[model samples]
Target: MQDEAFFDETEQLEEASSAPTDTAARKRAWRLRINYRFIVQHTPYILFLSGLALVYIANIHYTEKKIWDINRLDKEIRELKWDYISRKSDLMYNSKMSEVSDKVSGQGLKPLNTPPQKIEVEKK
Candidate 1:
């Protein structure tokens, strides 16, 4: 009877291995059933990891946006500095006496031709 049971078990094993498609289908069904169990067991951990991933992704995007804004502001600051320097130099050039005289010359305002002497008064 033991030998017959062993033979029957071996025959069942042989039948199970005989069809690859059937074995694969059984494996697929088993995996599908286990997938539900896996999710049920680890759902909280999965949700925690998902939240961490979202925070990580959002932090990366926020940092990148901040860096982009910093770069843009740096570029604008450089341009403004250049403009300030240019305007200051232009103001200095226009403030010179020669340029002032030239601008006023067109308005019929002439520069002094000679230096004047101060008069000395004696108390009597």
Candidate 2:
């Protein structure tokens, strides 16, 4: 008897839904409706997830900035190292004995022409 009643209700519902206008009406009723209570209940969790996403994005940007900075510093260091080597080589060339003599020639300084004479003196 209970099953007959249930089946009767289902038959009526199916018959009502079979009409095109009824189906459209049912579709309209089934349209999504916002549940504000659900949103309010899970607001914190949603905010936390949003925050996590922002932090993840920020971390990637920070890492990329650090990488760029490191690469720039490396390039600068290499340039400075090359400059240092060039200046050191220039200094070494300028300090050679032959180079020193040539530079001092303009100042009336001359290189030794002969070996130094060692003089011996009698002790008093």
lDDT scores in order: 0.95, 0.90
lDDT of 2 by residue, 1-124 (tens): 9999999999998887787898787766655333565577789999999999999999999999999999999999999999999999999999999999999999999889998999999999
Best TM-score among the predictions, by candidate number: 1
Report how far residue 92 has shifted in candidate 1, in Å. Answer: 0.8
**RMSD score of candidate 2 (Å):** 5.9
Q: Tell me, by lDDT, which candidate is best.
A: 1
Q: Write the per-residue lDDT of candidate 1 for residues 22-120, one digit (tens) a residue.
A: 889889999987899888989999999999999999999999999999999999999999999999999999999999999999999988889988999
> Once superposed on the true structure, which residue ranges of model 1 sit more than 4 Å away at CA?
1-33, 113-124
lDDT of 2 at 87: 100
TM-score of 1: 0.67
Q: What TM-score would every model get versus the actual structure? A: 0.67, 0.66
